[model samples]
Target: MKEEIKKHLENAITSYHHYYASGKLAAYIPALLEANPKAIGACILDKEGHWYCAGDYEKRFTIQSISKIVTLALAIMDNGEESVFSKMGYEPTGDSFNSLVRMEINRVPKPYNPMINAGAIVVTSMIKGEDNNEKLERIIDFFKRLTSNEELSIDGKVYLSEKETGHRNRALAYYMKEVGILSLDVEDVLDLYFQQCSILVNCQDLAKIAMVFANDGVDINTGEELVPKYIARKIRTIMVTCGMYDASGSFAVRVGLPAKSGVGGGIIALSPKKLGIGLYGPALDDKGNSIVGMKVLEELSRKLDLSIF
Candidate 1:
């Protein structure tokens, strides 16, 4: 089974590599432009501790928006569900992930969901910390535990790039602050949010983290409950509904797994109690998801009957 899965992953990577040309690097973030647009990788970790990997699985990239899931989980664990949800809704917004239009139109200007930039910023504020440094430390620590990689840390270049050029996110944070949705200092919240987005990871790291979710919040090897069962369940539900930005609905029909995509060309996906998948391809479609990564997952899902729906 290991050999078979590895072969399939290799085939998928080969078949979808050309799709990189159909997409472009996430040029808006200067640091992301440094990624090898042609690099495509995948890893699958099943419940029995088997790992099948192919392509450029070792290439590191920023965790990007994928950090939202961890941050949301940490916030819920820090504050009760009721407290967390009071700042953001769970509904999906068809708009772009970074767009602030919905906030402007709504009578109550809170972000529609934590998956989007506005909502993620608000959720980051909910994380208990005395300062941005402490909050960022907590977030990085959570990520390290989730991936079982104590070496996990931020990409300083990417963090600096995000902090300097993330004008849109800054706008969202300020608006939420003005509307009374955020009680914390806006710059501090944005700093923590940007810092979280810049945490470095690769396909293998992402797969290990996804495996925890696959096991309903428990570490597969150690039997440690990394996240409470209810919180893990809620995170998966939100990923299914909103993880792929505006392209989530179509991704659901085509792939049928709970997954999240990052602009850093990484995607984390899982089939409950079956397997966890991690993919990376820096070239992005219009929706900011990894184009090659999406194609690879679709092929794998079809071949392995891995779709949830």
Candidate 2:
């Protein structure tokens, strides 16, 4: 059965690889711009530890905004639910992940959710650490644990690139601070947020991390509960509603799973108790999601009947 599934995926990869050209690479971050827009990869990890992969799956890239999912989970685990959500809303913003228009228009101006840049910055500040370096170390360590990959680390070039070009993010942070939504030093929190986003990983690493989430926060292999069950449920709900930025609702109807996408052309999604999928494609649609990646997932979901809804 596993071999048949793998073969099906290989055939699907051949069909989807051609769609890469329709989307463009993320150009805002100079380092991310260097990625080969044509490259595509995917991997899946089943509940029993079976593995399947195809097309540049071994290639490494920065995780980008997908790291927000981890940081949000870590913040909730470290600071508890009430403290974190008090500063971040649970609803989707229905705007670009980095947009500041809503912040200015809303009366209270709390970031709609932790998945967006403004909200992510606030979530990073909730990490328990005396300094920026310490906070980053804590985040990195948590990622290593979730993926079971000690070698995972930030791409210095990408970090530097984002730090240099992330003016909008800086403005959001400053605005958040001014409105009292963020109490930490803007520079300190922004530094951590950029560093976290630049953490590099391959499709296999992402599949493993998604497996942990698929198992409801308990890593089946180690039998260790990484996140509280309740927290995992909340994370999954938010991913379904807001993980894909403004296009999340459409994605939910089509793919029907709790998933997240990153600007580095990576996506991690899961089907409860079934499998976890990781995909990468440098080309993006108008929504900043991996264009080829979404098509591939849609095909897989339809073939396997993996939709939760």
lDDT per model vs. reference: 0.92, 0.91
- In order of appearance, the predictions have TM-scores of 0.98, 0.98
- Specify the highest-lDDT model's number: 1
Pairs of residues at least 3 apart in sequence or in different chains that clash in candidate 1: none
For candidate 2, the lDDT comes to 0.91
Indicate the residue-level lDDT of 69 in model 1. Answer: 92
Per-residue alpha-carbon lDDT of model 2 for 11-55, expressed as tens digits? 878898988889988899989989998899999999899999999
Give me the runs in candidate 1 sitting further than 4 Å from their true place.
none
Kindly report which residue pairs in candidate 2 clash with one another: none
